[model samples]
Target: MKPIVAIGDVHGLEKWRSIVDEHEDCTIVFLGDYLDPYEYITRRQQLDNLRDIIELKKRRMDDVVLLLGNHDLHYFCDRALPGSRYDFQIERFAEAMFNANIELFQYAYQQGNRIFTHAGIQHSWFVDDFKGDLTQPIAHQLNNPESIQFNAMLRLGHARGGRIGKIGGIFWADISELTDPLHGYTQIVGHNRVDDITERCGYNDNKIIFCDCLRNGKYYYEE
Candidate 1:
């Protein structure tokens, strides 16, 4: 099998450029959160970084997969929603960019029994909110607009400051909200920040790998 390189939340960092360069032959999956950098990185830098990532996708259409994270979804939303470090100044530009290349982004990706999503998927949330067919490929069901509601994917659980008893959906799920990984699939995701790449096992030993440690110089590689 070809190698797979899963990158973590970018947050306007340039380390992804090097990771991609080193793994040019591998399937590159970005776990999203392309914007909203730390205090030091300027808004312009974040915008430029996003443009570069989009360009890379254009160049390597088949090899690269971009999943949308909560940070990114705010820019695409019809109106302002809750997001950390949201910049009103770049909203128009970022929205335009995303709208133009929206086809390149997706809610999930699947290969064999492994799935990739912006935030780890929870079993309860899938059963309650996902409108897609469980028998089908998870990514296919998610990417097809006819199969799911766009707004449903944006749900935020109580852990991330939403209503009590609610579990966040794919794009907005917090690590705390995911008590167990989705049944029958090993999921790789990035959303909640971590100090290093981490893995957790749930029911039936299903695996959920968290790789949102890019700010600390880390990524997940599989062959």
Candidate 2:
């Protein structure tokens, strides 16, 4: 398998440029959240950060994968992301950012048996709810997300919350309720808080790794 360098939440940090530059050959799967600056940051910094990230993906198209985050979903919704407390709002520039790299921003990417996403998956959402074809790669289904049925599945499963009766479903999942290792793949996720980039949930062979560790404007990755 190609050595994977999975990065976590980066809300417009310039250090991403250096991180990508350093890992010129490794496959870098970036967990999304490339927009909606922090409360204290200026909008210019947010634009610069996203622009840098977009440019990096453009330059490293095959090596980098940009998975969509709940914040990025603001474009799909008329309102702000959940629990953002209105501190973050959508803007016109978001359209440009989304348009620039629509092909690169998938919902999931797989490296060997480990999969990456803005959040983890709820197995039920795939097998039971959507009835997605198991013969196909999940990434293929996510990338071809123009179907109305698939869009419903995306909204139900990709946003934060216990929409699945109990808990866990990519963006909204509490991580604690993931319960199982999500059939066939050990999921790597963002959208949750952790002190370190390598912090993981679950146990043994079944684990969910959290990598949204951009607390400091520095780049981080899991080898």
Candidate 3:
């Protein structure tokens, strides 16, 4: 199997560009949070860099994947909602990301149900919950011809939390729901920034891998 390199929470593109340039053989999975909190007015440059990276990846490899995060969802909300509390820079950065057609949730799987998503999968999903292949319609819509269902799925209650039962935003549901007998998969996710290389949750079975070691325009790889 090809080695996997999952990038975490890149609000800017410079850092990712360097990493992408260096790791041509390993498939790079971008774990979302592509907008918000720009330290400088380089939104244009950063976005251009991101576009270049995407184009390069698409040309050079067949497995590059982009996983969407909650912040990415904010950009997709059509209008900025109240109490968002997101950084001011997000507005412009989000616009740029949307223009590039980046959205939430990207996945890659290899060997023994190994998968990479922006966040963890729930532990309680039964066999019935999954239509087929676990990814099913979500992946099909993305891969098929002119499908509107993919975009529609994004509007589901699970995408955004509200005054309702536990909606399981990208981070919580995807990561915590691996407790059921039918659920079995390892997912790489981003959202909560972690200074360390790895963080574990629930029993020894469930885990969330955060790759936020690099800060201030640099890519840090662990192991």
Candidate 4:
């Protein structure tokens, strides 16, 4: 199995640097929320940082998998209306990010006969849902350019169940652990801000790891 280093959420550049330095050689899983509500970076600086990170990931071959959290999709859409409710200083940069045709989400490794997804997959979808290898199913169903465009159309608010309840919400879609126990593979997620890791046990025993991030100046998960 490849050594996997999944960073929880990067709201601060310093914390991101720490994770990168600590897990340099491991396959890096950046568990989204790369935008919004961080005082460490100016809105413009945030865009530059995002671009640099994306570039670094490409340079490092396929070592990095960027899984989109709710916040990322919000930023992606905020590019359209600069003064919208969720719009921030990064709006201009959003255009650049979009025009570059960068991807917002990714899946990690499938190892030891089990696959890994960023958010938990619904009971409706899994590796067995595919007719061919895993990649083919993902590309045909969710990861295609047209599919991404469709998924990106709905705003985070609309995607939330509270506003208009449904199982198809992006949060519910990616954060798959909360909905069902993945019977076939281990599904990992990072969105529910738990004080510590939350684990669930069931017939299939799906494991959900809600990793911690930096709060204030302290690294929450560093030990």
Q: Number of the top candidate by TM-score?
A: 1
Candidate 4 local Cα displacement, residue 31, angstroms? 1.4
Off by over 4 Å in 1: 146-148
User: Candidate 1 at 32: error in angstroms?
Assistant: 0.8
Q: What TM-score would candidate 1 get against the native?
A: 0.95
User: Which regions of candidate 4 deviate over 4 angstroms?
Assistant: 38-40, 77-85, 101-118, 124-141, 145-159, 162-165, 168-179, 212-223
RMSD of 2: 3.4
Residue pairs with backbone overlap in model 1: none
Evaluate model 4: give its lDDT: 0.50
- Residue by residue across 185-204, what tens digits does model 4's lDDT show? 45455555545555565566
CA-lDDT, candidates in order: 0.86, 0.65, 0.50, 0.50
lDDT measured at residue 196 in model 2 versus the true structure, 0 to 100: 73
- For every model shown, the clashing-pair count is 0, 3, 12, 2
TM-scores for candidates 1 onward, in order: 0.95, 0.80, 0.64, 0.68
Tens-place lDDT per residue, model 2, 1-223, is 4567777777665556666668887888888877665656677887777777777778878887888887776654443345462233446677666866677678788766677877776566656655566677876665565565344434533235435464444555555545664676678888776767654444446567777776654334546
Error of 3 at 114 (Å): 1.9
What lDDT is reached at residue 71 by model 1? Answer: 85
Give the Å shift of residue 168 in candidate 4: 4.4
lDDT of 3 by residue, 178-206 (tens): 33212344445565455656655545354
Worst 10 residues of 2 by lDDT: 79-88
In model 3, where do residues sit more than 4 Å from their true spots?
Answer: 77-111, 125-167, 171-182, 201-205, 216-223
